[model samples]
Each structure stands twice: as structure tokens, then as C-alpha cells.
Target: MTEFQTIHPLGDVPPQSVESGDTSGITLNVRHEISMVQIFARNGREMELAKKLNIEGVPGRASETRSFTAFPLAPGQWMLVSKNAPGSGFGTGIAKKLKGIGYVSEQSDSRVCIRVSGSQARELLARGCRLDLHQSVASKGFCAQTPMAQVGVLLHQVNDGPTYDLYVYSGFARSFWEWLAHTAGQFGYSRGGRGH
Candidate 1:
């Protein structure tokens, strides 16, 4: 028998801090203990799927809770996220729950979640994101699929602090991080812990 160990997407990168002076305006964290699943409702079954999940019908919004968060990716697609211990099979559980109403694809290993937050968070993202992030247009519960630094990402605004969770493909995590670190330098940033 062979044994293997799970490695975090950004485990090899050292923690970083770029300060403009005595103050740091942004914080970056790699969320490693989360499980993500992409869900696509069967044609004409969007309402049934939402009802099964006990969430409002799929709209261009995000639904969050202490245990999980579901956000729309398109008209009939959504990404479900939840904190899970290693090997918890969170995606499998969701697949079972959704059963025939939706298709659930595990994205836990395919995507990386980077939490960007602080007073300057929105400012930093505006450098590369084209979305109009004005508070009135992109407050909490807002989510969209967009490109940042040429990398396709699912961006979710989680709070009024203007914090955002950028879910990028794991293969591009390092490149995205480098871009983020460089862009955030002017604002001064401190690296945070890997998980909750």
C-alpha cells in the first residue's frame, strides 16, 4: 500500500509583508480548509434545485451562512463552498443531496480561495478587475465570474469591509498570487494565516 499527504496549494510560498511605511492597508490569506463544488441545475429544474437546497432561486447573488456559501456563476450554475476538514467528502455529500436535480462537480482540489480584505482591498482589485465595485453596485452578497490578471476567477464580495474571495484555478494560483503581491505593494499588505 502507498500513502500520500495532501499539500496546500500555496504551502511552499513564504508569508510576505510589503509595507509602505508604518501602516499596512491590505491583508491576504490563502484559505486552505475549504471545499468547493460547482453545481449546474438540470435544464428547467433551477427552481427545483433551489428548493432542494432551501435557498432562493438562482439569482445574480450570493447566499452565505456560517456553514456554507452558494453563489451564482451563471443563469443555472452555482458554486457551493464550505469549510471542511481534510478528506471530509463535502462534495460527495452535496452530490448526494442534489441527486438528480443538479450536477455537482468537486472543485476543492481544482480551485484556490484567496481572501483579500482591508480598507484598500477594493482599490487593489480595481487595478486589474474591470467590474465597477462601488459599494452601491457590489455590496455584500454580490458575486460574479470575472478575469483578474488574465486569470479567470469567481469573485465574491463577502462583507462591507469590501473584502473579496477570489477563487482561481489551482494551476494559476502562484501566478495570481505574484500579480496580487505586486499590485498590492503600493497599498502595503500583510500576509495572513492559511486557514481559519
Candidate 2:
């Protein structure tokens, strides 16, 4: 591997050349592999770690995109997530600074998170979602636990760019893609509509 290997080859995650799809031209695409890392710490430790890391927000989050929705899930319980997968030392950086004890896990396989946002964001969701995502309830940083087309799902309502994030098990991407494709057709009937 060079300094950086252009992946998109054969793997559980994504390889190198994932393409932009266009059942209707909205162009659905994603990284071959979803990168995940989990931080396991006791209750009080999260707050302390957040303070030390200046926990203003989750890292690698991209909500703003002219007109879109990008919300975060409260950085929830695991403490935090970085743009890049951080290992033991990354956790230790905070652990040492904050004087706390905890464990860091690189969880690239356990869960698969897909970012979904675009002109026809809502339309694609209508394909297989049961949740009512109106303006008031589906605001930025807000999330809902629901299933898509029978699969368990965690939907994060974002503001600006990424309208939503679909969290599902690694085993269900193909079916989910099929579901999205069906609904996305209606969404792309007129082209990506500018809304979240």
C-alpha cells in the first residue's frame, strides 16, 4: 500500500471506483465501506472527554450544501466520532488529558452508516420509510429509530447538506438500495428538488 491506497477493490467495505447511479439521474452513490469507530466509556467520562476535546460537535459531519439538512445524533453516548477512524492513541490523547479511563474500538464492520442528502432526499425516503418527517419534527441533529422495508434503521435528520443518514446492518445494503431506487425514481422524475 502506498501512503494512501486507492481502495474500491474487493472487500466488505468499498473499494476504489464506486460509480454515480442514475435510475432517474439523481445519481446515488456511496463509499464502498462505511467507516465506524466506537468509544466505550462510563457515564461521567463522556462529559469530561467532551470538555477536553472541546466537544462543540461531531467531526466529519457535512450538513451544509447550499440547501440541505444535516443533523447529528447528539454525539450520543459513545462520546464522539472523528472524520478519520481514531484508534487507542487517539482515545488516549483525550484519556490522558482528561484523566479518564475507557476503551476505543474501531468498528468498521459492526454497523454500516450511509449518508443520504440531495435534491430528492425526502422522495427517496418515502420509498420505504414509515416515519413522518415533516419540517417541525425532522430538524437538524434530530434522529429517529425506525425500519426501512423491514430492516431496522436509524435515521438522522440533518440540515444543510446531508438531509439524512441511514444506519443499517452491513447485510442489508442491497435491499436498501433497491428500496431507495424505487422511490428515488419519483424523486428524480423532475430532477433533484432543492429541499431537505
Candidate 3:
């Protein structure tokens, strides 16, 4: 967890409310790796977590009733989330009770994350992605894996009502976010969607 801090997305774009400049909100606090820790359950338990989530998990789960957290999808499988230290508690705890589980590692520190909102979010994302961000395709709480700016990106379409969570690698973060802000300019974007 990180305390939110004000930041600037681009050199020319003034601060906007729709975008949060906090590095913690966008970039993982990870001391090692590239982004953050992302866990996907492969065994029955993890599948359960995916279904309960009501949204898509990276590796995905078998059914909505099946649930697992912080577990691995399979051998050598990886998940992303904020990882500076160790976070096996979320997965290990569940694995202890699971019958057949696999390896789980956090790659959050290995990547970067950003929250893209504001009225222009859909248009901004269109600059890099082909996913239909409309409500029909981008239902709240939905998660999708796609490329943004030619880099791997995990798009978390949270049902935060109207907010969206965009995550990428620290390396790609600076450029990727800048593109988002540039596109958002048309819909009138501000930090966190508030206003300058």
C-alpha cells in the first residue's frame, strides 16, 4: 500500500482530476522486479477465487463457485501485484488447505500500474488498445490482458462505478501514461477526473 501523492503525467499536459499522478497509484513500490504481484489460481481453490471475484483473473479460474486467492495457476505460472517484500500469505494460506496446488510468484514489482478515468478514458485507451471500453464490453470489475504502446498491459476495468485501473511495467509506464493523457485531452481530463 502507498500514500497517494500528486504527480504529473506529461510535460505539456497540465494536471487533471481524471488522472492521479501518485507513483504509488501507478508504479509499484517494489524495490526489486519490474512491476507488482499478480496471483492466479490454477487449482480448484484459485478457480474459486476467480469466480468469486466476478472479474477475470490473469490465468483465470474454472468457475464462479470455485475460489482461490494468491495461488498459482500452474507450474511456472506467474501473477502480478505490488511486490517489494514477500506476500505468500495470500496464496500460501489457501494452498495449505488445497489438495493440489502449483507455484505462485508475485510480479507486481516487475510491472507498473496506472489509474485512467475521467470522461475521456475510453477515447484515451483507444490510442493504444483495440478493446471496446464501452459498458457492454468493459463491464465493471472486468480484467483484460492486452498490449498498450506495444508493451504488455493489464487493464482492470473496476466496477468502481466509473473508474478504470490501468497497469503496466515501470519502464513502459512513463510513455504509456503520457499517451493516455494526450488522448484524454479531448474529453477534458484532469487529475482523478476532478479538474485542473
Best by lDDT: 1
TM-score of 2: 0.58
Residue-pair clashes, model 2: 20
Selected candidate, larger TM-score, 2 vs 3: 2
Task: Report the lDDT tens digits of candidate 1 across residue range 1-196.
Answer: 8799777667765543424212677878777778888899999999888877766544658887556799877877888899885369888888898888889888888998888887888999999999999998889888888899999989999898878999999999989988997888888664444431
lDDT for residue 155 in candidate 1, whole number 0-100:
92
* Model 1: residue 186 alpha-carbon error in angstroms: 0.8
User: Which one wins on TM-score?
Assistant: 1
Model 1 score (lDDT): 0.81
Clashes of each: 0, 20, 43
lDDT of 2 by residue, 1-196 (tens): 5596543221332321212433333445443433454454456565554444444335333233222222233453342333444233444444454444445555445455666666566666766788767665456665666788888776776564436767666677656655665566665533232221
User: In model 3, where do residues sit more than 4 Å from their true spots?
Assistant: 1-36, 40-100, 190-196
* Alpha-carbon TM-score of each model against the true structure: 0.87, 0.58, 0.55
